[model samples]
Target chain A: MHQIKTLSNRIRKNTGVDSIRCYQCGKCSAGCPLAGDMDFTPNTVMRMIQVEEKETDKKLLQSEAIWLCLSCEMCISRCPMEIDIPKVMDFLRQESLKEGLQNKSANHNIIPFHQSFLDMIRFTGRSYEIGLIADYKLRSKKILQDITLAPQMLMHGKLPIFPKAVKNRKNIKEIFKKTNML
Target chain B: MKKKLGFYPGCSLEGTAKEYSESVVSLSEQFDIELKQIPDWNCCGATAAHNLNKTLSLVLPSRILAQAQKNEMKEIVVPCAACYNRLSVTQYELLKNDQLKATVEQAIDMPLNTSIRILNVIQFIQEYILPEIPEKLSHTFDKKVACYYGCLLVRPHNILKFDRPESPQFMDEIMQMLGAETIDWPFKTECCGAGLSVSRTELVGKLSGKIVREALDRKAEAIIVACPMCHANLDMRRPAIDQYLEMKTEIPVLYITQAIGMACGLNERQTGTRRHLVKVIGNYFTKTRIPVENNENNPITVEEII
Candidate 1:
């Protein structure tokens, strides 16, 4: 929870908007699309900051609620004094993760697909959908869960069984090699 | 007289989103511009790169920057929002930090080329193409469109300066050039949960469906986007979006270029209209890639490619 102080201090210095200005008006919560799915609504997040309550729910860290914020400026725009609530929330999420607190709501076991995606870009400087999907299915077990759907996708000509690589993979790879992204 | 810039098509041009890319390229030709494909240009480590390693995030796009610099091109035009962000952000980081420049150049084994411009196709059309509008547009796009800037393009505004991070209008300006009515909606620059789409399909589906619904409720004839991922979500994933939300949303999502292409008298095929998932809003387009080279006097053709 050391990140709480870090997040608060950063918000105060950076945004210059007092978290105490919020009076639980619920406008932020009323406007949020993911309010029903959140453990803590936007107003609650603001209230949490006001009371400096030690959040018992470590779920805040692992929750996709933080990342799910569109940063649409709706919450801030609707605020009476225009406090930058989304930025404060973002800093909270970033600091929370830095302190080993993560939102489990956002975490999934899709590392292979995610990793293969990066690998494709790293190797060719572009994605090869066929290669990425193949590598993903080869590495992940969940593809079997949806094995029934892949054929259907291919049947519709939606998913090409074979994807073409960028005509100049070397040049593209050089961009990756240069960035150390490869 | 012609303005020429390096072009990086990313994956969409060669495959699913090929139509959108082709139309933009052809549109550029009409503007007296040459979009020279950056020889050996590659992807910019879009949604995947940053998700894997933060380091690869910068490195992947930095490689493309280096290649363009090596080709002696001062600017590179990216049509995809994800690619544009990766390229623009890498350019910003290198220009901002000298140490990063040296380190990146050392990694790519190329001399750093600093002064390169990173422009999204939307920005290019807004800055370059829109000016030529009065001459070309015979019809006005009187339909309402929700201009979806999406996450990668405007977020991290330090990299892409086309518009406000929270409420962007680069696409709006382009839409206006086409004489389309636009709605000032909340989710214009919002994230479509695109990065989470593959792993968390239901979540993305619900979220994307909501965006579509919002646009539809506002009576937008279409949802306009500059990102391929956003296009995929709002267009290709509509079936899942509808299934998850338990509502039908048939509103079409068009790339900003596709709309511009339409106004320019270019048909659906030229704009990648056929590749979209939702029903094509206007004339049906046969999917085909225009040959890289076309004579100026002849109108571009779009033949269905099997």
Candidate 2:
């Protein structure tokens, strides 16, 4: 019971967005392009956060809406309350990850994509596209997807054969460690 | 004083959007805009870092800004809108919150300089290209263009402050000056399924399809964009978009830099015209010859029409 009350308070402290501020205008969901694809719409997620019940709070974190959010600012731009829904979405995603509540119902390898992207930056201090894509494909098991486009992209000099690494590898590792990303 | 603008070409510039990098560099050379590449700069972590870890996101961009500060660079021309947004947003956030700034500095292990101005590609052009180069253009970009300003360039209006969030005219104005007919269309600041490009490609097809369909409906010949992600989805994802639309609404998507390069009389290949997945045809190069003949890249003066 006590934990449920802290959810909304933590959201305010972390993202500066108060769940209670939402007036259920449905403006955020109305503007969201990914609203149809999400397990819960933006407005529904806001409502759930406002409810602050144990079940709804857990479901809110478990919902795929947070991951689906583009953080495009379409909602915040249109919101009457001017609540930063994108910021709230980010906070929810981190919370979702902490609880291992990432939903895999949708055919979206979003987590793998994020992991592969971070791995590229963490290793070389710069993104190695070839490495990133290969790693993503392997992790997500979507190897055949976009295979045809690779040769065309390579021929056009769009796909670099080699990754350009940043000179200071030590600094990148240190930064990662200090940020608790290690 | 050395007149060099710091250039931080994000990961995409090195890969999928190599043409963008090429066109920008070529255009800079023609204008003699001494663009100094930030020495040993890292990736800005992008949407991935922000989605997963909060501090990692700020630190990544902070490190890049810190590197720019080492060279005493005042402004960095971030060609990628995503990178520009991240850098600008990080600067805005860190500058406002000292506690967060201290945490970011500790993580980055570098002296943060959030005061350095971060300019997007459009702003970069408005500052450098539009000043003196427009008059000297050997060729006119006499094509109808829908200037696409994806999410990051102008959205989250409070932080980015460059153009109007919804109906931005900066890109259109620049295109109009280049002698291209600019169309007033919806979805100017719309999301183009940016990072979900590879993961959920079908969604990108549907999302980016709307932008293309509207442009084609309005009779826009080509879509001009300033961001690499927009280009990838709009151009590289053409096959998917076409499949989704169930019609071959194929149109060339050119980077703002590439369009400028073509207007400066550089050939289609020089401006990375060949790199496009949906082949860039129709008024591909300069239609009329100009008087300027000295510059190696500039068009030669015509004696007569063959």
Candidate 3:
């Protein structure tokens, strides 16, 4: 119970999405592109937060809903109360990561992809496609997923071998340090 | 004097979506709009950062905005829709929340400036390119095009405020100005399952497949977009989309800048049309009724025309 309250307050403070403001309107779920794939619909996630049940809240954090959200902002666009459902999902995802909660639905590699993307940016101050793909493949062990497309991508110069690091990379590293991301 | 705007190409422009960056540069040059790249600009944190860390997401874009401010740029043009969304949303958030602004400034070690306006590719075109369309266009695009806004380009209507979030017409209107017939499609503002192109390939295929099918069903010769993610999914992920649909669809997904560049008499190479994975632009030129006289023997071969 205390955990649920702390989690809800943290989400509200971080995302500025008031769980109480969501009035069971299912417009978010209806407009969500990945609603069908989610373990909890967008509305259900919000309702779970409002209900303040610790187990359900933890389940919501561990469910595929947080990982599956595309952050397309469709839910907020259609929300009558302007509840930013995607931001809520983002907060839940951050919480899940901090708590080391692994999503039970492991079919998707979104978590690894997100981590790889951040790692790329943390290293180079910008995303390098080749490095990102390589890192993600190694982490997820799905190296064979897009092997066939490499030749075509290389031909078109879409996959550059070298990444151009930003000039002020020291400042970027300082940013990560100051934000406690390192 | 040429008008200059601060440009943030984002990481995708340097990587998987080089063609978009190329077209944007070429088209902007044609219009005499100088796009000065922001110096030492880092990643905008995109969809991934926000999901992982809120402070990092807000600080990353704020750093870029601070750089633009330092450059004395009044407006920053973000060609990538995802970058535009991140920058615009950060600006909106900073304006509304002083605590966030302070934290972001402290994190980035720079003074925060939320006044620097951020414009997406379409909005930039509507402002700078649309006015000069009549004088610039040498050949009319006589094919039907479906303008796909994807999601971030127009949604979160309160913050973006560029076009109708439900059914945007800025891209369609620009296409019409180039003499192309813009199709009225239902999925114009639909989500393309962005950032999931690599992680959840099957999901992107299903979502982008429906978008492609709708365009094809409406008899659109091509689908025009401004987002690099949309192009990557619709074009590079065509095989996956085909697998999901159990049918092959060869619709060329073009960046709006590419289409505009072509319509303005720029060669295929100049517009970076040769970089597309699906290869529909060649058929687009050959099938057009305008009869490009330069390549009578092989209108499909852009190199021949060049």
Candidate 4:
């Protein structure tokens, strides 16, 4: 059981959230709104990190739990030790992508959603709802999923037809590169 | 005296939540306040960036803050809780960690150093409007309402320090100022599944549906919120929510600004209330959107729409 590159070690390095400090109080899981939708509850995920077993770590990475986190911060708000579980969830999601071990079935659309969001920002430097929806539909192939809502949104002026850009979109593209998102 | 405050409407404010932006702007205008958009501001890199990369989240907000600093804005009003949280959290993260701040500064190619106060919509109202609200009120909003804080505005309590983490009272207090009856409810600070409303509609249905349900059971006439994300989940996703709960819920979700605007004599169209998916009922929400021959020239004013 090497300590350096383990999920706990990496999460600690990135977020400064020590999973070792999580006392398995189950308070986080209890408060989390999305706990029902998750494959692994927050407390169970914390316990797996505490155990630090290779099998559990691998299983956790591929699990849909990481992507399911809403980052609602309910867990940390209730946690006695003030463990930042939401931050840990973010790190785990990033790791899941790096290893290409993200759950293919349950949480497949989550990645596409995030990618489209980043792409929207990278190009326009502002969120373009129409652009985001169109790109997400292309990626997720749920083209007609919310197609009906568009006309209503446009009519109400909820969805702007053109993308809003910062005066300097060139800078935004460079940010994606520097952050290694490109 | 028109006091100037930097404005960062965020993406949702410009798009899906333009009504929120409109209400905020019109409401501020009535108070003789000027909200200038922070020059060439970029996206705050919202829930998506934080979910995948911390640096990107920090960098995106850093650019906005840098521009604010460059413009010499002493304080800026961020109407969106998600944007407020991101800017506040990034500032907290950057102030303490010079190393991370330096990296973000390099990425944005600007100085990260800033002390420009970032104020959420609630704080903005409390600071500027609340003092003079009693004097400016054209009428009181007498509806029974639930003040839904959602998350982000109050959570990460150690850093945000805006209100109580779980049971926040700021929005409630503001609603009280508008002469609205604020209901006592448990889900005031709960998660509304705002981040996933677009991609995970079912989950949002369950989460936001529960909030709306709680408000309904308590006999609230409206669910008042300050964040666009919360409004999107509670208002725009009403169909999914009705589907989830197996019941139609029509209690309108109003941004705090919209409620405040109505108090100051701004009509439903002026506050963009007609744009809401759920037709807001009652005397206050009576205007309907009307088509024009040339919308660009005949910008939809309150009188014209009414």
Error of 3 at B155 (Å): 1.6
Q: Compute the lDDT of residue B240 as modeled in candidate 4.
A: 92
* DockQ of candidate 4, scored on C-alphas against the true complex (2 decimals): 0.80
Per-prediction DockQ comes to 0.28, 0.84, 0.84, 0.80
How many angstroms is the interface RMSD of candidate 4?
Answer: 0.8
Clashes of each: 11, 0, 0, 0
Cα-based lDDT at residue A8, candidate 1: 46
Model 3 segments beyond 4 Å from truth? A1-6, A106-108, B281-306
Residues A30-65 of candidate 3: C-alpha lDDT, one tens digit per residue: 988889988888888888888777787788878888
The residue-by-residue lDDT of candidate 1 on A98-182, one tens digit each, is 6666555443334455668877765655677667766776765455544555554454345645555566666556655554543
List residue ranges in candidate 2 displaced over 4 A. A1-5, A106-108, B284-289, B295-306
Ranking by DockQ: 2, 3, 4, 1
Candidate 1's C-alpha runs over 4 A off are A1-110, A138-140, A144-182, B281-306
Q: Ten-residue segment with the worst summed lDDT in candidate 3 chain A?
A: A1-10
Alpha-carbon deviation at B41 in model 4, angstroms: 0.7
Which tens-of-lDDT digit does each residue in B227-306 have in candidate 1?
Answer: 77888777767777899778777788878887777666675555656556565544322223232333223232323332
Cα deviation at A3, candidate 1, in Å, is 16
Query: Regarding DockQ, does 2 or 4 come out ahead?
Result: 2
> What value does the lDDT take at residue B38 in candidate 2?
94
Better of 1 and 4 by TM-score: 4
